[model samples]
Target: MKVLVVGSGGREHALLWKAAQSPLVTALYAAPGNPGMEALAERVPWDGDLEALAEFAEREGIDLTLVGPEAPLVEGIADRFLERGLLVFGPTQRAAMIEGSKAFAKTLMERYGIPTARYRTFRDPILALEYLEEVGAPVVVKDSGLAAGKGVTVAFDLHQAKQAVANILNRAEGGEVVIEEYLEGVEATVLALTDGKSILPLIPSQDHKRLLDGDQGPMTGGMGAVAPFPMDEATQKQVEEGILKPLIQGLRAEGVLYRGVVYAGLMLTREGPKVLEFNARFGDPEAQAVLPLLESDLVELALRVAEGRLEGARPVWKPMAAAAIVLASPGYPEAPRKGIPLRIPEPPEGVLVFHAGTRLGPQGLETSGGRVLNVVGLGKDLEEALGRAYAFIPQIGFPGAIYRKDIGKKALRR
Candidate 1:
């Protein structure tokens, strides 16, 4: 079967890389894919047109189309393809509102009894600030609408909290904002495959969102990630039952046909696991780390989910651990410098390279976006995985490229 993977990022590259290993897939294509993906799949030129993509899928005899990013899913890419009777994996627009609108997600959680931080939505900045005064410091301020992953600010003080509120609403066209109490705990990601009915949870992974080491600096899409986060069985089970199950049941109760990966950004606090946010598709750097440890046939899994036939879809996972360290351009998650030459070598025996913001230019591969590449390492254990990944970081000559020195520090310490 021929398949099309959408988006251009490290996550998409990882998806295509895994899908290319499936013997069932006769051909592979990527829409607006990065140069790194060229080795595994044919790249298709696209202008981000949903309908046109559906038409292309129909024309190319693509058996299934799997989306890798949230923006297109929030814009109804899956719905568009379904409208053309083409099989696609992702949620419908209405279902995608869980990620598209923070305000909506908060309300849904409130209504469905999903464990989440205490929160309230505001349309007026003054009301938001007034609430800030009432709630005090150590809160999270968020743009109700999608702003990539940089939309959230975990403000430690009232001054920072108010500023976050003002910044989110002061966009060209003012927008809604959600202010919530910041839950203190370790954070981890749980991604599950669902047909809006049966839920199949994948291995939990942790992602580093801060741009600098030791969790300092602003939040980025993700700096790095490691699979099989060190969560006790009780906590891991709580995440699945307390968060994932209720999420799908709630969406179904709302009359939404949500079919795709359900990403739960969880804060595993003393009280229990509470959701920090929801994402419609797979997590970025997390995918780079987790997919490498998966032994199941991804193409077959996607096909079952797209067709809503996920009854006996038990995904198999390798016992190995995986780590992905992101190489970012200078000044990432703020102002990024572009066109810098990159010297990526043939990965060492155990490392895999996936590109995010890159282009094969006149001067060869150069940085094109904030996050440039994901260098993943697979090993017998998490420590070995991280060691292999860290040891190889310097060999890839990306001058001035920024990366976190402690990618798996959280799990290692635990």
Candidate 2:
């Protein structure tokens, strides 16, 4: 079967890598894929035009189309392909509102008794500031619309919280903001495959969102990630029963035919695991870290899910830990310096480099976006995985390259 994976980032690169390993895949292509994926799959130019993408898929006899990024999913890429009777993995536009609109997700959680943070939505900045004073500090301020994972700010003080509100509301087109009570605990990600009925949970992973080491600085798409998060069995069970199960039922009741990965960003608080957010697709660095552990043929699994036949898919995963450390361009999550030449020495035996934002330059590969590459490492355990990843950091050289020294420090201490 021929397949086309959408998007251009490290996540797409990982998906491309996984799909290439499937013997069932006869031909593979990535729409607007990065330089790293070019080695494995044929790259097709996609200008975010859904109609054109569908046309290309039809013309190329692509058996299945997998979406990698949230933008197109939120815009109804899956719905468009399904309308054409084409097999596509990812949620429809209405189903994607769980990630596209924080307010919508919060309302759904509230209506369905899903575990989540207490939150209120606001369209007016003044009303939002008023609530800020009422709620006090240490609250999370989030843009109701997508902001590339930087939309939410965990403000420690009233001033910072208010500033976040103003920043999100002051956008040219204007947008609503959601302010939720701060839940104290370690954060982890739970990704699951669902066919609008049966839900299959994947290994839990933790993502370090801060740009600097020691969890200091602003939030980025993700600085790095580690799979098989150190979560007690009790906490895992609570998430499965109270979050993932309820979420699937809720979407079904809402008349949404969701068929794809449902990512629940959870804060494992003392009260239990509370969802922080929901993503319509796989997490970025999380995908880089987790896909390597998947022992099943991804093409077959994706096809089954897309066709709403995941009941007996029986997906399998390796019993090993994986870590992905992101290497970013200078000034990432703010003003990034681009076009700098990047020097990545040949990866050590167990390391795989997935490009996030890069391009072939006159000198060599150069940084094209904030986050440039994801260096993934696999080992018998988390520590070994991290050690394998960290050893290659020094070998990679690029002007103004920035990366966190401690990628999986949270799990390491555990």
TM-score of 1: 0.99
lDDT tens readout by residue for model 2, 269-374? 8888899999999999899999999999888888888888888767788988999999898888899988998888889887999998999989878989999999
Cα deviation at 358, candidate 2, in Å, is: 0.6
Compose the digit string of candidate 1's lDDT tens values, residues 1-414: 999999999999999999999999999999999999998889999999999999999998899999999999999999899988889889999999999998899899888888999999998989999999999988999888988899999998999998888887877888999998889999999999999888998999999999999999998999999998888889888888878888889888889978999899999888999999999999999999999999999999999999999988898899999999999999888888999999988888779999999998898989999999999998999999988898888999899999999899999988
- Model 1 pairs in collision: none
TM-score of each: 0.99, 0.98
Collision pairs in model 2: none
lDDT, candidate 2, at 204: 93
Best by TM-score: 1
Relative to the true structure, candidate 2 reaches a TM of 0.98
RMSD (Cα, Å) of candidate 2?
1.0
Off by over 4 Å in 1: none
In model 2, what lDDT does residue 245 have? Answer: 83
The number of clashing residue pairs in each candidate reads: 0, 0
Worst 10 residues of 1 by lDDT: 165-174
